[model samples]
Target: MKRSKTSKSWMNEHVSDIFVRQAQSDGYRSRAAYKLIEANEKFKLLEKGMVVVDLGAAPGSWCQVINNAIGSQGKIFALDLLEMHPIKNVDFIQGDFRDELVLHELENKLNDLKVDLVISDMAPNISGIKTKDQAGIIHLNELALDFAINWMKPNGNFLVKSFIGEQYESFIEAARVVFTRVTTFKPKSSRDRSAEIFIVGQKIKNIEQLNDFGLE
Candidate 1:
């Protein structure tokens, strides 16, 4: 089958990307690993013995970062819609994490331990329609935020992939309502042309302070 021009261009660019070459040399699964590495450096988000959750964790690059950063005593629970080859010290659940059943499976794996950090590199399937794609991206962002609020320990951190578009500011504001501190970042490894950004929410607010963080 012939590849489209767009795909060919993407492939060529991907091949030439510095992060991709670096990841290959560093034995990381994908270039995405650098994004997390950069974020952790800036935020000090990881530490030994932390319980971390990685959503949309397939291809396992971010999990690789978590596994290395958190070390032996730390726990990593990863989930995705696609199958991921196993990584040491990482427990992977393959399913649509948005579904209640899949969420239950993840919860069961955690065994009641509140997560120290929740990182989602999730993105919805692109429909190529601007509004629809943005909506789907925002929906996943909201779901990831909700999951972190429900599952993370107080002072826990939430880092998620988000796209800049309609409702983007409101989404950031919603994060502010639930978390004591919220900030956004564009990792150096992130493509300049991409609208995607990472939102970091530190320390879930006290229960009394959180109202509707669901873009209400």
Candidate 2:
């Protein structure tokens, strides 16, 4: 198949990217690992003995980060629509995480254990339409947030990858309603031209506060 000029240009750029080179040298699956690593350093999001759920985990770079950071004491469940190669001490689930059947399977795997952290780097397939793409991205973030609300333990953290778009402010406000602290960050590892940002929501708020905020 002939590659389009745009794709060829992107390929050339991707091959020459510094983070891509670093990822190759560091044995990480993707450049995205550094984003998680940097966020953890600043936020102290991961801890020994913690239970984490990683959404959109393939090709498993973030799962690799979680695996190394958590050591033998922590548990990680990595979910994605595509199959991922196995990682030491990490559980992989292949399915659409938003589906009821998949969610049930995830819950069963956890065996009622509450999650200490919910990390999502999930993004919808880009369709090249601005509004449509934005909507897709926001919907994924909403699904991730909803999962965090239902499953995260108190004082747990929710770290999600998002973009500055139509739903950005409202999404952050929704996070503020459920979490005691919410902040947006962009890692230096991310491409300067990219709009991606990480929204960190710390310490789940009580139900009363959620209701007060009209989030319940």
**TM-scores for every candidate against the unseen true structure:** 0.94, 0.93
How high is the CA lDDT of each candidate model?
A: 0.91, 0.90
How many clashes show up per model? 0, 0
Task: Tell me, by lDDT, which candidate is best.
Answer: 1
RMSD of each: 2.2, 1.7
State the lDDT of candidate 2 residue by residue for 89-132, as single tens digits: 88989999768899888889998899999999988777878788
Quote the lDDT for 115 in model 2: 95
RMSD of candidate 2 to true structure, Å: 1.7
